[model samples]
Target: MDRPQIPLNALRAFESAARHLSLTRAAVELCVTQAAISHQIKSLEERLGVNLFRRVPRGLVLTDEGAALVPVLTTAFDRMSDTLDRFMDGRFHETLHVGVVGTFAVGWLMPRLRAFEALHPSVDLRIYTNNNRVDLAGEGLDLAIRFGDGSWRATVAERLFSAPMSPLCRPEVAHVLASPQHLEGQALLRSYRADEWPRWFEAAQAPCPPLRGPMFDTSLALAEMAAAGHGVALLPVRLFATYLENGRLARPFEAEVETGSYWLTRLHSREPSPAMRAFREWLVDAARAADERPDLLRENALSATDQSL
Candidate 1:
């Protein structure tokens, strides 16, 4: 059996008429006369040998054949429209999907995203946030910004920068801590990585206490908990600069321990697209600029102290 030769215009007319259930409204949308819309639909019905619609007194009702055909036509038209929308300024828009850790997404990347958008208007960048843990291939991600030592298996990881872990808490909590030893009595908030608090204690030359506080997967949540005076949380102080600057959280006893660095990672099996390359370059440049700004970091770390004094 041969496929029926149907005109695109007739199919469009039938689809519009079916959606509106009125030839007059469909004609208005299509910028054609009611008579022309009726003629196109009639021609489509004859080509398929089907009674697509039943003309009623109020408007129109679809038959069983029309009901089945509507979905097919709607899907086809939607896909066509989406494809056509990608073409802008005589070039096709390239899509780049990135998965970033929640901490980095909110604290670091959110501030600079507008810069990325301004630099690359042709790239459709989509970002998804997760905890530090992510599956690049499993989640169908083109790239992932993760916080850890660049040692994941089957991945090409580029070190962005290291954010040292430090103790951040509310002003009232910091006021009581003249020395690191005072933290032993306070509730110590913990991350899924159990060794962070212990490592931080070692850096401060204080005895490590048995941690029993609430554990969180994301640093963003842990930082919020600390800011709310739940307990002292060990976090990346540089990343949480906004909170520090605003006096919501304060870093006490400036003893920061380096546990891991953030990395830009992608599956080794996957090839990088042009959009991905552009994003990678921009991110690297941004990270470098941030690293060169030690004065900014110092200002944020000291802002809470200045406010309290």
Candidate 2:
């Protein structure tokens, strides 16, 4: 079957006139004479063998045929315009899809996204947050930022930094926790990783309590629960610094247990794109800068001085 030829200009004129319900208004919008708009619409209606508009005393009224055609033309034009806008200075925009753990996504990555966008204007970065557990291949993700030992099968991983686990709770809870031993009586909030609390307790040289508390999949939720004074949650303090600084959460002890590190990972078989390479480099530098904070340096210096004495 062959399709009949339709003039794009006539379609545009009809659509504009149908929207405004006035030939004069359509002509003003299209920068043409009122007579030209009317002629185009009349020609279009004749070609289709239908009455598109009925001339009323004050304005035009769309016939049943005109109403049916308006929505289809409007949608097509809008999609075409949106697609065309993606090309800038003859270069097509590249989209970078990243899946990140909810904890890192909220606590760290989101805050630094503006800097990434400013530096890489041509790359459209899209982030999907997940609970640490992610399938890079199944989800069609370009990269995954995970918190673990970086030993997943068929995946290449680059270490970001170690985020040690520590007991964090509300200000009221911290005041009661005068020592590591005091945590034994409190409601210790837990995550799916059962060994985290035990390991943190060992680091503090405190006796581990009976494993009993509500479990969470993500640290972000656990931190929120702790902030609300539900229980003491073992969290990555580096990521939840804002919560600590704002007094919503507090670390009762300085002891922290290094269970795992955050890593930038992707399928080992997949080749890196230009955008991926740029992001990887930028992220590594950012992490290094974050690790070398002035407070951390001073703490290290003080520890060294005490050891010398």
Candidate 3:
């Protein structure tokens, strides 16, 4: 069976009109006169022998048939636009859309990204930052870097680095926290994760502080709040190194608790590309180098001294 021919101009006019529900606005978008837009729509309707839109006094409204077609047309147009955009570069390149946790991007990956760019100059990288919670397939993300227990069901996880939580506060507030137990009386800034504070306390063998402060979506936010003297935040020492090094924020004690390790994760069904493989290799090597740093008194690997931290 042969399909009927579709008028490109008429379809464009109808799609625009359907989107804005106004011929005038559609004309503005199409860069044509309103009369031209109306004529194209009418021509489309006459050719199809069906009413695509109902013109009310104020604006146009899509009929049931038009309403059903809008999404399909919109999706097709969007995909076409995206595909065409890649061809405009005149090179065969793959786009890797990666979603990274905010804390990791700021604390670790942002500084080291130049190395990856140097290696894979042809691969286009689009990074979306989220707060640990990510949708791999729904967001069309190739990879997600997050701190977790490696329990995500549909993803393959590769361990990157461990984040340890400890009491971090402004230097002025550090005096109030003489011991791990003293944290109980101070204002305890919290994360969205309910168990973080309690788990940290358990690891340090200290009493849990009364949870009373702003709950931050990211450790970076919590660290900033702590640096501003709002309250004490249980932060990943590795992530908040800049503040610690610059004396903006200070660790009250040496009590470090293993919160979770950062992981490079992707959908189990996602096939690996050369660019992805290179990135993974580079990331793993970086993680290993950080772990093997021969510096404690010599240099602060866990503190803000290491760029990867």
Q: Assess each prediction's global lDDT (C-alpha) against the native.
A: 0.91, 0.86, 0.81
TM-score of candidate 2 on Cα atoms, chains taken together? 0.69
- Kindly list the per-residue Cα lDDT of model 3 for residues 128-224, writing each as its tens digit: 9999999999998888898889889989999987877778887777866667888777788988889988988888887785787568788888888
Q: How much is the lDDT of residue 286 in candidate 1?
A: 97
Our tally of clashes for model 1 stands at 0
Q: Lowest summed-lDDT stretch of 10 residues in model 2?
A: 300-309
Q: How close to the true structure is residue 174 of candidate 2, measured as C-alpha lDDT?
A: 82
Ranking by TM-score: 1, 3, 2
Best candidate (score: TM-score): 1
Residue pairs with backbone overlap in model 1: none
Q: What are the clash counts of all predictions, listed in order?
A: 0, 0, 1
* Between candidates 1 and 2, the lDDT winner: 1
- lDDT, candidate 1, 120-144, per-residue tens: 9989999999997788988999999
